[model samples]
Target: MSESNTPEQNSQPASATPPKQESLLANLLINIAIPALILAKLSGDDWLGTKWAIVVALAFPLLYGLRDFLQNGKANFFSGLGVVSILLTGGISLMELDAKYIAMKEAAIPALLGIATVVSLRTRWPLVKTFLYNDKVLDTDKIAAKLEDNNNLGAFELTLKQASWMVAASFFLSSVLNYVLAKVILTSPPGSEAFNAELGKMTALSYPVIVVPSMIVLILAMVFLFRRIGKLTGLKLEDIMAAHHR
Candidate 1:
């Protein structure tokens, strides 16, 4: 006869299964391509109509967020926020207001992130570290040891905080560009084919229009950061950037 089972025995199956996670490209397709496609191809006076198309298109992103929550028992920050943004964007579009509301929705996300980046400086973990210095890009452990060896840790942290301000500036710049791009391109009243077509154009142009410039700023931040790190640690630039190659 078997011995009496404990609660831990019964819970093993649930805990042992690996969680399902969506791929980055899949997530982007769900969020950006699906919505843009539905709006561009289906949203028109003769098709699903603007209101219904927007509602239907919005469902794809919401489903992505729901899937994330179900598997992990929690939502990813960007994923959850993407779903909420879609809801707000859809709701605003359905309000029969001018096109500017959509433009505002587009701008609000980056603007808020910029504000949060500035606010995070007051906390223990500055957002700059995650953006530019995390394990994926830069090895904090190796740098920490180097800093301790050289007695440069304090100065390094100070440099990171200063870099965070520049990061915030880049985000604010993107926020302004986002608003202006939407206004200039999204002139057709919401829900029309012209509107949907323009939306597609904006989506297509975003990489070149907004992302390229923002990346230039982020690249500059990385350059300034590495240069400071080298100065503080007395390490060669190649030695300091070994974190990236590894």
Candidate 2:
């Protein structure tokens, strides 16, 4: 006879063993420092010529992204987007374009993304799920069951649509910020040391400039959503949010 593991033996609590979170230092070093340093120090110099140096600098993020994808067995949506953006930047740099071109380039990505997010709302499976739902973040199945039991599924989905609109608006805000930041910071010609330095500066500032604000918006959206869920399903916040399990 085979024995099945009891909940006591099988369960691992989220609080007991916290998920390992990425560190700020690691994020800075890998995402900003390594690429920025190489570009600033060697990009405009005669070492590999400006063109190839840009390529090498671009390679750092690409290699890192590829390694992550291979290790994870799939490229994450954001990482894949980052790689595409890197390629675009590299191409623009190699073209010997002016700073405004780079500025336009920088803005293009977020603008397109913002547009896409809003457009996706029209589809059956909205892209909000990628940002908000999924097993890693919350147990959608459990929430759905609760909603069904409470006869609040329709109302819950409408609430999600409202939340999704707020999210789209945040992306649009990011797009404007991205454009302005790039336009202001990247004032030197591409392939110049000053240009590379400005690029470095842009990378360094992006967290405070973009990420912090975006996260605040996201948190507000989450709060709004959970509050509605609480009202509709009459579930505690903890009950609606997934339990940490191992």
Candidate 3:
């Protein structure tokens, strides 16, 4: 005979699904290209004007961040910083502040990250692991197990500490580049059409100027970490990397 389940059994919570990953193209278009285009092309006397243009350009990133958070069902450190950065930019432009403030704002984010990356080395969790050596890209659990078996776990930690410094260097590089780029590009006074166009120019240039160099350093750091992991654990690169990457 078939039996019916109790209400308690039937009311069990559904399994939680993984958070959706943001697409790189969508992120770039929303945060960089579209905003830059709007600020550059639309910020004119006949178009959106200085105030409205800043508002509209900043809105894309703000809305995109909100949507990403909603899709993930949580907040992240970088996303929170992005929101703060947007607010600061909007506030400065709307208030017609000095152009230097915008440059400082651009530099501050990466500077803060560089400081945090250095400081986190003293703690149990290093930012290097979060950025490079994490399970998202590496078979961390397997590597850890192998390290333990080989009595190289302490050695691995030392290697991670070195890699953390390298990561910090990348952040510092980005911070310097950001400041210089901003100081050079954002010369026009804030809340002017010329200033808006300059802001757009800075945005367009930032990817190739600041981001690419920082990314190269990060890639080098990752390679260094992987090589050290292989030496310590005697694992092949194919085995060291996560299944998805392989």
Better of 1 and 2 by TM-score: 2
lDDT of 2 at 231: 89
CA error at residue 33 for candidate 2, angstroms = 2.4
> What local distance difference test score does each model get?
0.76, 0.74, 0.86
Worst 10 residues of 1 by lDDT: 13-22
**What are the clashing pairs of model 3?**
none
lDDT of 1 by residue, 167-218 (tens): 9888888888889999999888775767766776676566677877988998
Ranking by lDDT: 3, 1, 2
RMSD of each: 8.0, 4.1, 6.9
Query: What TM-scores do the predictions have?
Result: 0.77, 0.85, 0.89
Q: Where is model 1 more than 4 Å wrong at Cα? A: 1-24, 69-73, 234-245
Q: Can you write out model 3's per-residue Cα lDDT over 1-246, one digit (the tens) per residue? A: 012245533432222112223367777788899999999999998999988999999999999888879978999889989999999989998999998998899888998998999899898888987898887678888899999999998999889889988999998999999899989988887889999999888888889999999999999998999999999999999998765555
Model 1 score (lDDT): 0.76
Top TM-score: which candidate number?
Answer: 3
Better of 1 and 3 by TM-score: 3
Runs of candidate 2 with Cα error greater than 4 angstroms are: 1-20, 23-25, 44-49
